[model samples]
Target: MSAWAADRQRSRVRPGDPGWPSDVSWQQLNQQVGGALIKVESPIAACVEAPTSAACAQLFKSLRNPYFIGDDVALTQHLGWVDAWTSKPSAYAVAARNASDVAAAVHFARRNNLRLVVKGGGHSYQGTSNAADSLLVWTRRMNEIRLHDGFVAAGCGGHVAPQRAVSVGAGAVWAQVYDAVTTQRGAYVQGGGCTTVGVAGLVQSGGFGSFSKAFGTAAANLLEAEVVTADGQVRVANACTNPELFWGLKGGGGGSLGVITRLTLRVHELPEKFGAVDMSIKAASPEAFRRLIGLFIDFYGKRLMNPHWGEQVRLQTNNIMRVSMLCQGLDRGAAQHAWQPFLEAVSAAPGDFRFESSPVIVSMTARDYWVPTTLKRALGLVKVDDRPGAPISNMYWPGDQLTVGEFVHGFDSAWLPAALLRDDQREALSDALFASSRQWWISLYFNKGLAGGSAEAIDAAKDTATSPAVLDAFALAIIGAEEQPAYPGIAGHEPDLARGRRAAQGIARAVAELRKVAPNGGAYVAESNYFEPDWQRAYWGTNYPRLQAAKTQFDPEGLFFVHNGVGSEDWSADGFSRKA
Candidate 1:
């Protein structure tokens, strides 16, 4: 069956659910959304049990050139970019080229009291990033990166390439930005893990990277921001300037803070040459298992290790795991030297180990930062782009003591390597590494020495959301299924509850553990799964109260509700009921 038909049968909820009203209340909601923003329209008239003859009008006016409009015309002047993780579409969007445009939209929404969704350069798990029924404002066109007064001032309404970075910035488009800075400009940045995510999500969510252990989280490098408040006024915020907002935005999930228009970031020097490597283990024997886990523990305990060495391991099942090591130094040879210990630890046994390595050239000038995550996040990447399934939820993984064996061991069934693999590319890489293992694959990222290499200093900073555990890294589980579980009533239709629940339970366990390790630990907002609001509060803990206050003070009308954003009511004492 076609993907759309198959999904319709499995969606968690549909438009016509009882909660989706068609009465006067619905009409009133429609009217509010209609005039919420200038040049914006509403789609309430199209719903069944509708009111009058009028439908949400197309956003364009009588001008010969038609640009910007409702969901139908979103493809023209995109106010939002569709997320690649899931097929969930954004209802309406706006490409705000200037801050004034942002002001206009905010003011319009305030006047009409409509719900507004803000679009960054990435995706949300469901319809949070972009949706069909809500108002959207795309901020990709605001791409202008400049170096001014020893600081990098980036535009907000659109994607802004970083002004500078010592390594890389948080909320950066990993691969793309890495390629641009290192490959093109000979500079590099330490961004939030994923290459296709966004800076907005990263910065607000207290971004962490390989260098976080070295230089600290992306938030540590931030200097200031020009944000469009709910009041439709732009303000430059920092420890000195709206310090409270600055503190909240530092790691408090972007949407919750305000519409960030520009980010004044700290930039740094890049490494001369970097090493990227991925290794796999069969671990068919006890010795192999001991070596794998032993090496992991040793590396975690190392003190002489490179300040730039960043390593990660994923043991799928059967004691098999993939280890990725990155070290940034003056030379690739030196990087290799720092990585030698882990390599030796895993390759001690024959037929049980396989590894690959690549050299990453570093930037020497205009150090640090990049954005424009993925093509799907860009207007150009949307049409004919391949945005697959399952929305990515930002989660708080605050601990470092997790084992893949535990997750798969208790499943009461065999685990497939395919399940752990994020996409086809990883599968190919895995095949090239293993001749016998057919059930799993390892994903890899090079550009080691993120910040200072290990997460040791991060623990000291305690700067992340909820004061996350300082030593933990990040993981991105890319899957191709969008529908949640339900009793299968049709072909290819199965409930995602059990599976989703398992994922949630595992994440919940991780969060609980992190709180124990580094209570300040938190994950990027884009990675949130939207399973529990309270857990989310834990992810953005210390800042939730302040964010709510910002909403109450700036947007008392509560007309703005960006997708995946922390809603004002959700933070209120009464809001606790929504989590249930």
Candidate 2:
């Protein structure tokens, strides 16, 4: 069931609402479902008839992620705020509850010959989740998490496959039921990014976490997977079942081998209320910023060899910047002591500045946070449209980590709309900033340790794909709102899509540069810094050919072809480009 599906009746919308699933399209599609595919009638029929629906109760079709089901104009609002994100139309969404749902979607797409896209939380900037015209298999409703057996199994299987055989296993998104008595019912499916990211997609990118150095990446911890091949057969993929596929998922990436349903992962005993700290500072000059950023590099080096040290810093790309910091340790006092040097560095600044520094223990268990509904509910933001659009393009800071093509030595780009950035800064200087309760704002994320987080575990053979040099990973985001406005003219709906392309290039550059610095820059399966196909080999290194071979064996029919899908046209047996 979708976490956001309150009730059919409660979700029912009246006439003035956004894209209220018109009887026209749904009815037509149901009638002409092609050949063997089942003809789904109402929302309930669509739910139960779904392939993955068998794993859970039939009452879940309406279920969706709490983040996905906002007002009609929410997408447009976000588009306005962002330059690279895609704002999907909700009517085309499938609220999958398990692996079976993904299987059903694949079966239906193949039978009906419709293009398909597998989605977890749809956090990608390239908008790969919302293809121009394709069947969207969304795993948002498959958010049910629990522990099972010695492995962890998601209520719905939404894991990603490995991109290249040499990369890693095909695990993406995150979470599962853990069965170890020591772990109780908890799982170690290692989720990436916010809780919203899927279990399957995260592990594919090499998950970065505070415990990565200790546990290895989420991919290193994986044991097995249940996959739905392109031909529609369900099978197990692992060192035993399909060793190549498993190898691909390790450090490889998702969206390659097949659609993952359930993941069998190695679970660990976690500590309660791990020590936490947060701090921020304003810079006086560019020299100070570099000095501070350079100081951080040293701490990063020490933390790499030290098992107990954990730290994250957020640096502004602008000349005059604000710094936000977080640190974690075995205990509060321990963390405070470890952070003293950083605090002293701030005091040694060339000029005086007010700083927010403190020590506070944070709750760590994975409990859902109840965000205040606030006015987003009061007036029903759907009550407005002209002001809505996708959020702005965001820049990420990998701290010291870099990629194969991206070089931070002289990195610079203005992802924000030029007008918007100038206006905001000028307004701030004038002591006036735009005020809108529903407006979306950019947020910086700081995570210590690349996917290969802690140094606790060392599997030389398994650690080949992993690296020890990377100390942190970070990303920028627009917390709320959908599309934002660029121009009132054709740009609003023209779908230029240049922003997505540019953002992808920028990320690619960063990743490329990192690959140059660290012979082994620690891979994070969850972060897919976009790279052009020609340059993709840089990210995968020696893993490309193996993935091509698997594609030839599994999808020879070439029945599946979609934009940004995967594989080149030459590899497709049927002359269809997987990423066409």
Candidate 3:
């Protein structure tokens, strides 16, 4: 075996380990970062100590606010996954405010042989950003967003031409970025659907948004990045410099290869309009539901399989199909026109299907979609942060509110190949959807797949470390379940283990149904099954080997690790020890 391989066959130092850093060392490192070191604690620690205190009451209320959870170094958007992982505060956190601070933290962690965790938005459903007895590099204080009319990568001034782009600090979230780039500047940058997701994490995980079909993934749009690698060097990674590292940073999974300080992403011209088609149709019987699924699949394959449409369609166990799809570059009339055939078909079959509510097909100026006032007055579709001194612009989708501090029971996803949409294969695909829904509700996120995207979009995604399966898949089928704000040892907020376990089994069965049609499908790294047996292939496909090489080159000693991230196979499940 190789020297590095042999070296990894050992345990990592933990809190009680003899090699653990001393207080003096920690203090010295804290001084290096301008006294930004924080002793991390559970968000509910105050509640655990005094359940009846006003502070505890306030803490419970704050848990529902994603921004509040994100700002805290100890918490994650997802509290935990039942029977799998729980949110745990690190021993200490370095509240990094700049690349220098990040590098200082990295150097300290490496020197002390510490298990390091990196958190920007802290939204990892897999609990990747949370670990007990580890040091956290918290980038929340580093938020800074700047736009460039024209920008070029470092060391490629002559080779690559300048392009319109936006540079965002690692801690900056999608809402903040969208407000600047789209609402204010009248341009578009591909990002995650959840507005508060950290830009750095999403890009590194192959981000998808409502309009990804038009602009491609956030990773594919990356122009450059400032990353602090494990060696304590702050390096600029782009196509022109540290090319291999740059490739790995795109869709290679976050907190593995390096700590991103900032990213510059290519910007595209904002479409004239952005729109949505919201409707729910409940079939009267199982036979009707099967027909409804078949009809929708046919409609999607024929009319909606293109760059103009994105978002999702939900197939529920109640024999209901919900359409929450979005569109861009199209006016209200055109958007409605595109759906007329499907709507007519459902209407004609009124005996078999019934509308849950009046179908909504609405369109608005693309620039206004993320504007707080527009969202409030025009759509009435946002939940604003009510905390005192919160920015008026601090708003999130109501749809995202349910999972703010959820403890997931189970979550799994698989890419459904575009071929499944073919006329000859649509029946099998429809049958799979119906069967999956019977087990658990399944959502097909069209934007997460790249098959019907523009050639430029597909070409760019191919260069990233994401699974090749994504290039041919029309949608990503996701099945998941969660409960509100549950944490172990938190008196009344303890997780519902019995209920959670049942939901987990249902989720597994649901995904099994999808697997019948897509048995060899690859899964998205950022949002996939936590207990994926063959994670390397599920996450990166053939790209795993290349990503592994990059991880070895940059983080040879495995100082940086996250659950299921590249090169993590060498380490134990808890990431505190290497596998023998």
lDDT of 3 by residue, 251-341 (tens): 9999999999999999999999999999999999999999999999999998999999999999999998999999999999999899999
Ranking by TM-score: 3, 1, 2
TM-score against native, each model: 0.59, 0.59, 0.97
Which sections of candidate 3 miss by over 4 Å? 1-9, 374-379
What do the candidate models score in CA lDDT, each in turn?
Answer: 0.43, 0.39, 0.90
Candidate 2 achieves a global lDDT of 0.39
Off by over 4 Å in 1: 1-91, 152-185, 286-291, 303-306, 351-468, 471-525, 562-580
Candidate 3, clashing residue pairs? none
lDDT tens per residue, model 2, 1-580: 5533433212223233452335564444444432212221223223234534543232221122223222111121122113333344333544455565567666655654444555664444334444434455555444443344333223323454332111122222221222121133332333342333445665654554544544555666666777777877777767656777666666555556577666656655544334445556555655555555445444434442344433343444342223333332355556666667766776776484336444343433322111112343253411111223521111112221112111111111111111212333333311111111012122323343432234444452154232222333322111211212221122113323454345434444443433332323333223332222432343344555665666667766554432223463333222222232
Number of the top lDDT candidate: 3
Superior by TM-score: candidate 1 or candidate 3: 3
